[model samples]
Target: MSVQDAFAAPRSAVRDVNGGTGAITDTVINALKKTRPWVLFLAILGFIGAALTLLVGIAVVISSMMMGNLEGMDAEIAPFGSGMMIGVGVLYAVMAVIYFLSALYLLRYAGAIKRLSSSLSVADLEAALEQQASFWKLIGILVLISIVLTVVMLLAGLGGALFMGAAGL
Candidate 1:
């Protein structure tokens, strides 16, 4: 994708959707109605997944604390296990937060669709599309964050490996 497209708000949401007196047209409403069921289902699924993620994070942290005593091991090594587990749990918590927010946006989008279905007005249509746009914008930001984090972690791992090799560890 071009730099402009990459940086731009989700194309699907910002793109001009032609409409009548209201900003959005009938065709947009028709399409939204068609996707309403799927949108609702996805939002519900996201909520469930976010809850599970949070639970897993709590479990990890608790389990790590319980198992952190590397009994009989060197003091230097003992902290590593606990720290890694805690870090992973924290990451999971962060993921859950992002997941929950994304789901909320989706749920709101679905609500907008419902509103449009009932009112069939230009205002309702515009609001519904705005919700949809918000959802996509969040998802795009999350993807970019994930990519950066992955690259950073990879580089850290590589750097550690090189350091170890150089030190003859």
Candidate 2:
């Protein structure tokens, strides 16, 4: 059958396999609508976190420079601080990239939801869902990486801070 013919509705199956006018589609669309807002909120939060990390890194660098004792500081502690800062910066950059990619995926999903709402064929809906699943998988990987990086950065910062405090620097 031609592509158009495949998308054509099956008259005999108008009532669907079970009872009701395809309420499952409506349910899924509603869920997507509810989820879109949360996704947008998360993206915004990610951006904010990245911005805060950048600001904190800048503050640390400035404070270190102004201390005049930057060169006099313990070499071990200095390396730890520098490494922590660099790790945090890398984490923030990764988070920003993840946020942008996830946002794009969510926006595309939102568009698909709209098309489904407007009575897209089941084939079209299925295709959209397949594409969404791939995007979700990528998003999941990015989120996991971001979490791991953030934790590493946090631990490094804590260790550096403790060392600095103990050394009376």
Candidate 3:
């Protein structure tokens, strides 16, 4: 093929490719309709998982307190006290809340999909996608925070190792 032909598609070809926006939209709508049941399942599972996580966190805190009251425990051997356990439990509870919020967003997305199935409007589809975006955005922010925490913890561990080595401990 000549360089000109290779570099550019004919206008007819371009128009043909660009002309199917409506078809594409219809295809997307159909696919979303087909996936409605799965989305509903996901929303239900997410809510259940969030609730379970919150309950587990609360249980951890309560168990830590009960364990603290037990006798014949060496503080040096078991460094975790009720205070530390409470902190850990609180962290778990916070995580549960974040999970629940994200799950709620997923539920919102599912609801939007249901609405779009009935209305078949671009606005409804956009609203559904927006909820999906919100859920992913929250997850992305949490992942970034986790990466920073991991790096900080690694550095702290390295520093401690160096200190201990230098001190001949």
Instruction: State which candidate has the highest TM-score.
Output: 1
Worst lDDT 10-window in candidate 2: 13-22
lDDT of 2 by residue, 19-106 (tens): 4434244556567667756755765665566566566656655554555346687877877776666666565555556656665665
- The segments of candidate 2 whose C-alpha lies over 4 angstroms from its true place after superposition are 1-71, 140-169
Off by over 4 Å in 3: 1-24, 75-79
* lDDT (C-alpha) at residue 48 in model 3: 86
Kindly list the per-residue Cα lDDT of model 3 for residues 1-169, writing each as its tens digit.
6456666755431211224442225567778888777877877887888888889889989988888887888876444787788888898889888878877887888899898877766678789889889989998999999999999999999999999999999
Instruction: Score residue 16 of candidate 2 by CA lDDT.
Output: 41
Best by lDDT: 1
lDDT (CA) for every model shown? 0.84, 0.64, 0.79
lDDT of 1 by residue, 29-78 (tens): 67898899898898899899999999999999998887776478777866
Q: Which residue pairs in candidate 3 have backbone atoms (N, alpha carbon, C) closer than 3 angstroms, thus clashing?
A: none
Each candidate: RMSD: 12.1, 10.1, 8.7
